[model samples]
Target chain A: MLDKTLIGRESESTLVEVERGAIRRLADAVGDANPVHTDEAAARSAGFASLAAPLTFPGVLAQNERFRHSLDLGTRSLLLGEASIEYGRPIVAGDRLTVKTKVADVQERAGTSGATDVLILETEGRGAEGEFVFRTRETYILRRG
Target chain B: MLLARQLYFEAVKVGDELPPLVKPPVDRSQVARFCGATGDYGPLHVDEPFARNAGFPSVLVPGMLAMGFLGELVTDWLRGARVRRFGARFVKIVWPGDVVTVRGRVADRRFEAGGRYAVDIEVWGENQRGELVVRGAVTAQLFYSGDDETRQRGGQPPLVVTPAEEEERLAKLSRSTAPARPAVGTRPAAAPAKVQPAKPAAVPQKGAPPVPVQAKVPPRPEPKPVAKPAPKAPVKKAPAKKAPAPKSVPKKAAPKTKAGKRR
Candidate 1:
């Protein structure tokens, strides 16, 4: 069972740089083929410094060390049931971001098989200039062993 | 050739449907490529054995992949429209061999601060079996040909300044460099402004960036381009903070868990 007390726990903010290569890889992975997210000149003409980060890019920041340690989900079967991200602006390559995540709620609900733990986590990302850039909310379902 | 056409708020109707973005059937190689691209090498996404051991029949496609399809659908229609906010909810598992099609409709339209307008689209994805796999909405700021020079900002339009004559435009711009809080999740105006039909002869050349289709509109009286210089100041702020980013890259290079590996 997930520790109920873990609710409301927050993690230390971690800083990450948005890399151009990483943005290109994400564009390729998604099969977007949008030049704005892959080619620098295309991005420049589109009004971005480097390649623009995909809409889902900020979710990767949740994998930071502080969030993992704070969740204390140790070896548990965790499934990413759902995720949603709200962007303040398009995140471009060469931008620095600070990510801080926290467990918003934890609850045990009865399932068809048995009891399951549902943890709601919210991650907020801010640009280096201290402006809110994006926020992602994810729901993780813990497998009942 | 199809991607070169620009979609403007003045031309699109509320019920107009966007062209569907259909993706090839998912496969293992594609999964591996996605993993390498996002740096999310989750065992469940890359290793069949790991996924089978975890009770899944085979490696599963990441939800983000479906989200990407939705992104492509909107941006393709938008052409150069700026995406201010996008949100999605993953509803089902998309496995290899499942072809996904993204569909969208112009849900709402509204006038915003600068001369630009906003288009709200309801977008979603489904598999070949017709199962709804993901649903979301997007708020994008796009330029219209009718916009006067006093408010030439394209994507990031300033907030709606309550008219008090001269105080209307200048006061809002001077108050905050930050964009007005995004009007997310809210429906734009019910009755849209007048929309003009697009010209048929505006087809663009192959592979070249799609030009905004609204370029064919008749020219109007020119006003001072006030919002033109706003974007440059914010672009310079990012590079200053970029110097320390490379130094921290090595520290975050590897996976935190045994099951999660960097490609």
Candidate 2:
């Protein structure tokens, strides 16, 4: 198997722009049905700059190479059952964020179904001001079939 | 007022909710700002006309943006350790002006190959309607408290090696390091403003250098560049931090539990 440590790494830092249309589009996909998510007029009335994204916008900030850790732990299967997030601050449109992320850890567990591998990655999205705009700990559970 | 709370491995237990991470509602201006700043101009992010044509109730939130909120939660809880492995799946869309709160609870703790206790973490995004659009999990390396007691005040403490001393140690080991490899081409073009004035294509590397992908050297508008400037126009890129090994290094075993390391 290829070395998991080699792939369980990060690339150079890149900057990302948060556009408004994306927030509304993602809202539509989730069926949020909230006027705040889609209605520009509604946002204007609510005292906002433009349409905003739901609070989960930061979930996709940090990503890794696929199957980067399959051979690291001794598990062939990883299954995901539940996920949750707690917002420190609301996500606004037009925010320039710098996300620094890294491979946090990898583990194996014995379950009723079988052995599973869990990979944890962390990311911090800082705005221009260096304030804590957003942060997240993303996870991947690769189950051994 | 915001007070900082550090979640140590010894004090953590499964099902314990780290303090609630509250995010205000999203707005159009901020959404567009997020689009510009994040560089994820998927039309669906800011193009309202295109969105209506595509058939949807309203514009949707970027999945990665919502995840960024989760990243903030981890930083506060872990007190600045790198979150090793993070992954999430987009189940639902989040729109502007919707209040999405981040919430997570410890799931389990187990030792990795090196006796390092890996904390299983799960997080999600909830809208005003309390709907969850995204879910994820993570493992964090933390500094525990026991070590603090031993090293309290003035004593031979762990992590006490001065930077100069560490530099000396690293210098001694540098003899075994390999030579620099040739640069690789192929960085995306639409670059940000450069931090300093320099040749459009070249960058000087210091210690632990970065990939050439980070060095395309965005062409600044001015011909005469400033000296020793910070990299200008940093877009919000989620590159993993720390040393990026190649595809052949051996996987690390569960780290051994030291006296007070909390990761």
Question: Per-candidate DockQ versus the true complex?
Answer: 0.18, 0.04
Candidate 1 lDDT, tens digit per residue, B74-179?
Answer: 7766766677777665555677766676667676666666554667777766555444556567778765532321245454444343235324444575577563
* lDDT tens digits by residue: candidate 2, A28-94: 4433444655677654443345555554556545433332342344423222222233333445577
* Model 1 chain B poorest 10 in a row by lDDT: B229-238
Best by TM-score: 1
Maximum-lDDT candidate: 1
Worst 10 residues of 2 chain B by lDDT: B181-190
Error of 2 at B263 (Å): 25
Interface RMSDs of the predictions, in order, are: 9.8, 14.0
TM-score of chain B of 1: 0.56
RMSD to the true structure for each prediction, in A, is 16.6, 23.8
Clashes of each: 1, 143
Question: What TM value does model 1 have?
Answer: 0.68
